[model samples]
Target: MRKLFFYTKQQFFNFKAMQTAAGFKLLSMSQLLSSQKVGELNKNQKYYVDLSSVMGYTKTNDSQQMLFEQLFDSFGENIDFICDKMYEEDIKYIFRYIFDDFSDVDAASEEIIAEKETIIETPSRKRRIVDLNDKELDDFFKVFDASLYGHERFKEEFKKLVTAYRVFNKIGEHKILSLFLMGDSGVGKTEVARAIHKALGSRTKLAKVNFGNYSSHDALNSLIGSPLGYIGSDGGELLKRIQESDVGLILIDEFEKADSAVFNYFLDVLENGKVVNSQADEYDVNGYIIVFTSNITKENFRSKVSPELRSRFDYKGMFNLLTDTDKKKYVHFRVNQIISKYKEFVSEDIPDGLHDRVVCEVDVSKYKNMRDLNKKIKDTFVKLIGA
Candidate 1:
């Protein structure tokens, strides 16, 4: 195994240069001379000359007088003169002074390989959603607050949700948090789900299913194969993928739009953390997190979904319309993100005063929330870019 060594300036000099500078090669000779000295060297001199004592080099005591006589005659000045002048104090300069040609070559090669591996390995590790550490989580919320545009109350609610999950995780009970997010259209219901999924860290770790996709007659068959109807159809609709990703996230978009029959089965998974396949075998879903996103308001949802089904979820988050303040912030944030992202596309800075003009001209009354703003921005961009 190769090891990298770190050295302090004083220590490096003591080990690499001081002993070699003086004529003494045996350690005993240097020690006898220091002890027999009429006057002791100061801390600075000792620190400078202590190199020989630490490096295990220098002449022996039997040859000490000869070595001293040799040391005195070997140079224009005494050992003390050399000690007074320490080398220039830069790491690169110090390294060049200490490491040999072969040592330098080996160190450089090791560094190159390490850097190459880091560059090569990073992509495989990056994901759309990254779990946040304490500091990262704080930054994430701050960015999210800015991104959402004017939902200070919503941000507070989000903070509470995050805190709840963290607290639950600490107690070992938050491994699978089933959240039901109900709200009006164009707020941030779906965005919140996507954000949560991203925060968790990987697209592969998240499985998004559209309830509308399950409306067909073959939907059930697609989920779980025919009882005995076909060959090479052993895998059911999304069963294997969901099973394999036990600790992953599952987002059911437009939950209200899904067929009653499909949701009936989902009820079982939500409540019991287990799903029975067509084969009548129960698969454990204890480690899976289920997120249900709907455009319906809580009042309507309360009327639509039964009390029994509502009780299964740990929390029900309400995504309301964005306040005016949120709209301005959101617009500013989005403009900045776009400008920063496509800076190379524009030679001048963001079409000159475009952000302020858009924010001022935007019809806030017509837009209810983030979803509306996002759609308006999307349409506006198409016209602006002529793409």
Candidate 2:
């Protein structure tokens, strides 16, 4: 059986030596037809190459793709394809067109070697959950509980989870605290991350990635960065956001909308407790909280996501619509905040009844989502101030 060499760019030196020792010639797709030097090839000789590097999923011209196809048709049997950090299906997609007698479903054997890890270290502002002291952790929880309305049960569960995580994490047991929140849209699903960000006392934006935009065929490239140095050659949105944030929290919005490649990539992140970006920069997220929010129901969550991934979550809970009482409390809290801001910025001569009058204009039962309720509160404030 012929062995198809699959190695990462980090292990290129080993692959180059091993392939050259054999009869196979090592040639890039660019060097195959584009190079000026022409050499006569012996019949039945083998060659190692990256087929999709020049003939990529996107951006490669029709003429270039046709050239690769013709090259494959001529040397399909005489070629041992080299895959650089690419999935097997992607490699097969290129081969599907050339070989009509393609019977090797799983013939590509991965070359397993000791990988030399490449890390791009930057001065990062990393304050992990494990770093917080007792009083500081209490302060964080206080802010977290106050910022998010309702979910009393979830808050209690989260407190217990964190208390245990702190102990286990200190002993090198637990790595990451992951939450899979399944709920309806606008039901304060993302509010969990916002509350955590506020509680962390960060002076910067929250680290968030909306997977709705990552549902494309090349979603993985956009997320972790494209190989061969496209836009995300520096490690995609995930690494960039993590690097920029001071807090040890990551919010992945619309989790169910992401591609399977993304799902597989995150599986590794959760298992390893570190993010190795496309540029090979290694960032430790051991004490981080990665919150994944999805609008999918309990049934879909089971049928859609894989079981291996489903078991990795520390907590999976559903968020319900805020009760009328909770909503009223939120309205009051928001109005009081607006009044406080107005007094500090615009005028401190506001009457005491102004708070109650503003709250009275709004009916919480009219809205299902907190966003709409917030909008109603804003409109009432504007109208009352105009009067």
Candidate 3:
């Protein structure tokens, strides 16, 4: 009969010592029991079995206790069962009842001792987001109002969305708030997400997935991933971007450009508030706000998007071109920003009247598109600075 080994939780994760001592790789109990036969070992070879998963299984199914005992016995001398100290008594009793000379091996080998001195440390992968207290939520609204310009109706609706999300997050069935914005290009459709990210005080880049780049046949695979056992099957661009971001907001720009597969995938995501990659790993986006920006017209939107998907959006609104007054405000904001940056870095003093001069130079009436307005501001700034 093989002796059962009890390890501390710390020791179980120390792969080098465990692998060398057992003369085989370590595997969780679930992996060993799974139907996949890719890495199956022969009868004579030994393997280290992680008992944590076994403990969880046996706790749920009292009837499986006898079956697991029989299966462990069948592995015979080829398996070394490794478990944490808390499960020692249960494991000991199960082994003693099945085998006559069940005992634990307590002696530490010289190799294990040496390997312990050089234990490989793994970096933690814990994700953290900026959490707002009640006081902070009020401050968040103040910042949001100042940063986002124009579209007063949408702004009011967004505030209501945030308030509802905070109040009902714990009890509501819907876990995510999804907004669909459709309008002409440069109408601040994408800016809505930028404003929210800034209001959250996020220092990291906003999580963005542009569907304009994913119009191919395998767009779903490129967005999530190919299935396991296939090439390039790692968590795809969307997951990677989300993991890198500090805020719980995702921007899908040019949303109408994606294939139907991508649309269906997102419908499932909006419904469940979770995204499952092709590898079967799931990411929780419970408190997230996903904004979809599109250039599709109202008529095309109804025709292109299915009714089921269209109905899932929490708010669907068309963003209009910024009013002339809003454009003037944006011009003043941009000029001030440029002047502030120049004052901070340049040794030469900028003229006190430079902002007014630059704003006057930019004829806002000539430009309806925000992108074109922004270009004019940049051009005027350069000309004034050079003069």
Candidate 4:
């Protein structure tokens, strides 16, 4: 049986899981080192070490190298190692010097085959709505429509584009459906992604990356990860989130804030339907939906975005603020939903007309931002409940 194991950074897709057993013990490199010093280590115990957290690899230490040799020699079996790709060279050193049987697992092992079959491979996975047939898609759209409170015009345009995309997709003409939504804050822009995620029956959260927090100089590096082999380098947050999600939708929020490097990166992603990280690891995003939401005005959009990049968007729709009537309807729905939850959780009695009372207090015309309207609803509910 193979005794040495290395959990690569790619495997930590926003979630790392392990099962604890009676003989199994999880340790950081430091903890293992401490155990080595005390001579308390037991060969009967299974060891899992997160070697990535060992920062002592700053320079080659002869004592540490000898310790590793002695440590493993003490317990030859049942050892799991983790290496953040930053220290692949060091892990390789250990692999060559210590374990000659296999690198990560036995050559042509079933475990490696299963890992390749599941994680980071696009072909093995099913595309959510893209895999849906005509009748199935129609049903999905209905659920998507009801999930959002407003944006009727954008919804209609989306339905048409999706239908056209489905036909083009079959012929290999269209690789992905792109939506470039321009809007003010709090106008159901990101909600489009959430709705699609829910409608697609994904139990995981929507895959999303917001460029607003990134500076122009470092945006590309952060998006795809810093160039490989850099200290603390790993597969990027974007790819990890995509791997974590079970759906085909990806949301890029605050799109205009990202620099041209990021823009060009995505332009290629849109064109090729494959996201290649700095490490040259490819993630195929074909048959996926990529939604880009930006708050830049029409004038600024034309000025900030290049024409070549502009032409790549399949649908560029401006999301308008909800109408007062729609806002009122939203308030009513929220109130009823909140009251039902309150009843379920708190088991409290409420006035028969409490929903109406809460709804009437929220004046939708006074707030243009749906987020502000939502806050008002919550405040009103709390006040009425306290009364």
Q: List the candidates' TM-scores in order.
A: 0.56, 0.67, 0.65, 0.67
lDDT by residue (tens digit), candidate 2, 1-387: 233445655566654543332223566665556323223332333557665465464244545556555555445455666666554455455555653332221221324321111111232335567778886788678668877888899999999999999999889999899999999988998998888887776545788999888656867877778786575365789888887777789999998988778888889999989987777878889889999999999999998899889998999988999899999878866776676568658996865467679888898889998899999999989888867
- Which candidate comes out best when scored by TM-score? 4
Q: lDDT, candidate 2, residue 360?
A: 87
Lowest summed lDDT window (length 10), candidate 3: 120-129
Better of 1 and 4 by TM-score: 4
Quote the lDDT for 366 in model 3: 90
lDDT per residue for candidate 1 within 1-387, as digits (tens), equals 111133334344333322222111212224435433423322111111222232222222334334543443332222321111132232223223232221110012334434544553232232212234665566446435433444466567667866776666556565556778887777776665555554433324556666667665666666666566566556575566564342245777778775555667777777666766676666655545577888877687888777777887777878777777667666655654454345536643445555555556566667885666767876665455442
Model 3, 1-387: lDDT tens digits are: 565566664444443332432234455677666323313443434466767667766766778776666666446465666667788777666556553443333334556645633432211121112246665566556556656668889989988877776666658666788899999998888888887786665556889999788766878898888989996578888888887776688999998988789889999999898878887877888778899999999999999999989998989999999999988877866676566556557844876567779888888889878999999999988888888
Greater lDDT among 1 and 4 belongs to 4
- In terms of lDDT, the poorest run of 10 residues in model 4 is 14-23
Q: State the C-alpha lDDT per candidate.
A: 0.51, 0.73, 0.72, 0.73
Q: How many backbone clashes does candidate 3 have?
A: 0
After superposition on all C-alphas, the RMSD of every candidate to the true structure, in Å, is 19.5, 28.2, 25.0, 20.7
